[model samples]
Target: MPDTPAAPRFRSGAGRICLDFMRTLRLRGMDGATEELDTPEALAAWVAQLGPYPGGTKIPAPAEGVLGEARAVREAVYALLTAARSPAGPAGCPPKERGLLNRAAAAAPPVPVLDAAGSVTWTAGDPVGAVLADIARDALSLATSPALDRVRACSGPHCAAWFLDTSRPGNRRWCSMETCGNQAKKHAWRTRHATATAI
Candidate 1:
């Protein structure tokens, strides 16, 4: 039998659920924009990859309506963070987007259950929606918290993602050192070599 193909790998470790979800719409407001959650199956895949489910847990695909709502919530999250990070701050957000974000934040996130071994596992009646709810709530808290100042857009030339700069010096520039930072170092080396050769 033919082997089942693997699901596409999604990016993670943006320091916040909302920031990670925001990347589903890659290159937001920029050229070559791509939608990662284009279908219900894709939405389920995201939840399976990012949600707090145990290993090998199968995340059932949500309804088409749920996919739409997920996208809406993602946009609302982006809008809210944008406003909050701007000079005017969260107060600059108009009421409509704020309401959407607030409603999403109000959703029931995954609940924790402790087994006899004292192991904790997260459960949710609607896993996809629950993850999205956690994202919304995270965004709401992050936007209002003093940690908002720590948020920074990645300096990678090809990257448009944002991340919380937890570095003590507050000088982080890339989303992932393994990816963007390494690429930058190579580029800088090539440029220096070229300049030396020309001289």
Candidate 2:
């Protein structure tokens, strides 16, 4: 029997919590858009993978209302950032999006706990909401700072993701070298090979 393939997991390393969260709606504003956070359990799973929670910690799935709120927060982050990256800058951030971010940011975030074992773990009364708050705060900071210039939309033809250009030269592209980057490289190679063979 063929070996079972690993599951497709959430994308990360976007350089900001909010940016990473924004990708939960993969291929946003593009064809084949996929909603990865379609369920409350999926939101909890995202917190486990992306939040400051410790490994093996069980995050309870939020209620339907909270799930809706989290999705709203994610969209707000995306819209706010898109506007901030524009020529109009942060001023382009709409009042509705700004207010949503403000409310989300006001919520309590995960509390850090230091143990005698020299390990730190995070806890929150509402883990999902806490993670949302963290994302909101991060979005607010990124949208207004000079670092906004470093945030870039992926160059992948079909990818609607964004990532921070942390390279020294600020020429980084693609959301991940393992995914979109690899696909782009393969495509380029195939194009070159096809041209060479034709000639």
Candidate 3:
């Protein structure tokens, strides 16, 4: 049997579901970007892995066009958030994309369910649509909330990831300290040593 490809790791540092959804765009550092959610099965798997889903709950197969819709929604959310991060706030989501999100938001809204521990957790009746709705809602909230001011794109060259600056001084510039931050530190250290040796 062929080995199954590993699922893309979803980064949650963006501090918002919508931003995390946008991170699904693979190879953000490359010219030829890959689509992480490339198929219906991938979409189903993503939905199953979302934080709200109960463990072992069998998600229904996505209907035809659902994958396309998901990609469309993802792009729309990306564009809107990118614009919002700019000095000038986003003009707003394009009409067609907004309509797509609104429709999804209206269909199969997530409901809070009580888990075995009696804590409230959300679940959607139609997993795909519900996930989209939750993402749409989160995007809208981020666009309108004060948290918009805290959103920052990674400073690493070739990296296009965004993250929320939740640090005390609010000066964070990388998607992660372990990845881009470390790379930058190493590069600076090498440059300093090279200059010292030449001198």
User: Which candidate gets the maximum TM-score versus the true structure?
Assistant: 2
Clashes of 1: 0
- Candidate 2: where are CA atoms >4 Å away? 1-8
Compose the digit string of candidate 2's lDDT tens values, residues 49-129.
889998778999889898899999999998899889888787788899899999999999999999999998899999998
lDDT of each: 0.89, 0.91, 0.78
Clashing pairs in 1: none
Q: Rank the candidates by TM-score, best first.
A: 2, 1, 3
TM-scores for all candidates: the values are 0.94, 0.94, 0.84
Q: Where does the lowest 10-residue lDDT sum fall in candidate 2?
A: 5-14
What's the residue-level lDDT of 67 in candidate 2?
A: 88
Runs in model 3 lying further than 4 Å from the true structure: 1-8, 27-30, 86-88, 115-117
* Pairs with steric clashes in candidate 2: none
Better of 2 and 3 by lDDT: 2
Task: Give the C-alpha miss distance for residue 144 in model 2, angstroms.
Answer: 1.0
**What TM value does model 2 have?**
0.94
Q: Candidate 1 on 88-171: residue-level lDDT in tens? A: 798877688889888887889999999999999999999998998898899899999998999998888888899888899998
